[model samples]
Target: MENQWLQVSYADLLQATDGFSSANLIGVGSFGSVYKGILECFETVVAVKVLNLLQQGAFKSLAAEWEALRNIRHRNLVKILTVCSSINFNGNDFKALVFEYMPNGSLEKWLHPNVDEQPQLRNLNLTQRLNIAIDVASASSSSFENTNHDLKPGNVLLDDDMVAHVGDFGLARFLSEAAESCSQNQTSTFGIKGSIGYIPPEYGMGGKASKYGDVYSYGILLLKMITGKRPTNDMFKDNQSLHHFAKSAFPEQVMEIIDPRLLQENAEAFLDSENHNNLKNKMRDCLVALVRVGVSCSAESPGERMEMREIAMEMHAVRDLYLEVGIQ
Candidate 1:
């Protein structure tokens, strides 16, 4: 059966976004520009990603995204509404993708809030963070069967309810049949596929993209969410990295490295003596477990990393524990 996707006309999108006006442009990336638009036929809000056909890599990315999105269906994954391929008024080749608009935007902006933004806008509490983590984990685990070569904060979008939806499959690729029979020493033909900070260590040595590499990238993302620090943070000098920094602070010193906003949000709950310090203890335990999972999944050796199945189960358990403790 042909893939179930709407083939929208270029004129409708032009009308929707007022000819892709600058005011409608919401995001710009290596592949294309994303504009906020409302499709009049359906009366629905959508994100229109118009690919830059002039860029050599954009064509491959467009194909990869279409192939991956058409084959996958999961609650935590981004939903594609339609696609457009045609010539523009200027007679230039145009290719675009329309997606369900995510009101809350990317996880990157929320985690590392803009300096000029209001303080109230920057906070993401422990419970919300845990929920987002679970959402991403579920998406990652589901996508492992047809691995996403790129997994990072920028790719994680939040809906109106703050539920995370993993998007951007431009670099995705399924493991080839030959890969299953090849020796471990053989390098991947797909080439290096992830953003700098999230790339797995083995990929540096010409390793192939595998479920393990996705896990490593997810690990880095998890650590970044918890600590409010990117893998490329300046503090990670003298052989230190986000992974090692988080690993070293495990169990005892977790709070020291944890996002201050998270702590501040729950300060009153921690101060409640009637709970008999139960909330505090549960939070600490949850943090320790979460950090351990991050470290284990991002292990320097791909062979040492935990599988997504295990990571998913453990993360769900952690979220359950957090909810059970009633630490709001």
Candidate 2:
């Protein structure tokens, strides 16, 4: 039952996961399959992760994940209920992580959403969207701000309540104060992690990971939440990334890229020049701020970026102002 991290019995994991059957499988993951399970403790519904150890080096990464999850917790960070280790068949070196189940899956699934649950989009008003972004920003400010490391969307999971919890520590790192002080270093990669497209260009070039990288990634998520476009959408298909493409346009072509779902309420003059007459038109200022924030965070120069805490403050200011004026 317990260790540095809570220990989960293999049998319970197997039973709860129905022997890892397809019926119980919730989704295929990059590293393993996630199954819906119930923990013996409180009959807690949890995500049973059966990690794949195909590569010899992957075991080390798995161990790192275990250690990282055990050492930290945050409302936005996924809670690890328990883990199962060791095995009988194939060396029975089985390893698994049991986390609180998030019925809504992830923001990625929600952004593009699905036909069966299209109505759910209605629940995400401007206030709710801003709140979601704030939650993520706060979590990032807490987690990565300490380690000066960033996580990608795959690492961000949303519970049924639409509350975002930062998860997936496989790429997280603990930077010594000494290490954090160095602004520009080549081997500066914080374990060389971050999802592609979401990865800061400097990180890809083997530079350091910082709170700014997380801020940069959050900005992308903001764009996705607003436009319902993946970082790899067709708009970005011809090698023009959204950040780069949006640089020159700002509030001008903003409507061209906003999510159609969000445009429904403003149908009368969503494109009307008179639309600028409304206070929400000032949202252009927010979008402009957003573009600057994204560009800075993803800046090839890490020195140019704002820290995550600053980002959270900026969002709070923007969202507060938006709500004050009742912008539709």
Candidate 3:
């Protein structure tokens, strides 16, 4: 494919990233390292993804990301600002892509905050979490035709205003092309392309890339965000998946498994007798609905899983109901 993106010089990127110093490093992935930089010309903060050409699939990933992001436009999707492909100061081939900076980092950090960090920074209220879940569902529903093969918490970024943006399109593929010859019931041979715990069960059985796989991954992500537990957490051993873990808790013990910070933050409001019981019941009902949705979307059978559009709609209703209860 011809490079159609606006290209920036290596020297300029080097300067913007302060010689790619450690301090500027924001994220490290299989393809490359992403650095937070400020473009002198635009005077705007941006994320610069410097490709590690030596990595196994770095070149393909770079091209895939460009192809996936170029034509797509969504509020919840990260915007690519520009591209850079040139010889660096050492004469080595360099390729980088710039994206709009997201100041709030990612969902992973918030869901599983670093113990070493301040306690206040780790808290994500019910409203914020619900909004983020809706944002992700909206993004995935819009891109269902173009399945994001790798959907995980680490790939979901948050802007300064806390709007969730689904990103990392390196493993993205169009289901229309990949599933043309296969029937809905039949599995197609697609190499495993998603993170371990987030991958759909059928994919391990040779299922092809389809919208259902994305739904499964999104389901896992929703569960993770709700419970603050990684799908691959060590506690999930002995064939106890995150789905089962959450399912077992269901409507009653969900609060026990949920992020304590969430409960702690909302505990004060439920101190009154009559109003407190009413609000608590409303909260419980909402939690039940949320977990049910998560379970339905993450069903082991692809045919049993809910569609992205349906998931998005249900999340919106849940959020609306939660808001209606007047809980902060």
Q: What TM-score number comes out for model 2?
A: 0.81
Tens-digit lDDT track of model 1 for 111-187: 98788988677678888889898888888887445556478888899999999998887854422222344454442
lDDT of 3 by residue, 247-311 (tens): 89986788778777777777888884459888888887787888888888898999999989999
Please give the TM-score that candidate 1 achieves against the real structure: 0.91
Q: Each candidate: RMSD to true structure?
A: 3.6, 4.8, 3.8
Q: What global local distance difference test value does model 3 have?
A: 0.81
Off by over 4 Å in 2: 1-6, 88-91, 114-123, 148-150, 172-194, 237-239, 266-276, 282-285
TM-scores for every predicted model = 0.91, 0.81, 0.90
After TM-score superposition, what is the CA distance of residue 326 in candidate 1 from its true location, in Å?
1.1
- What order do you get sorting by lDDT, best first? 1, 3, 2
Predicted candidate 3: what Cα RMSD to the true structure? 3.8
Question: 1 or 2, which is superior by TM-score?
Answer: 1
Better structure of 2 and 3 per TM-score: 3
Q: Specify the poorest-scoring 10-residue window by lDDT in model 2.
A: 171-180
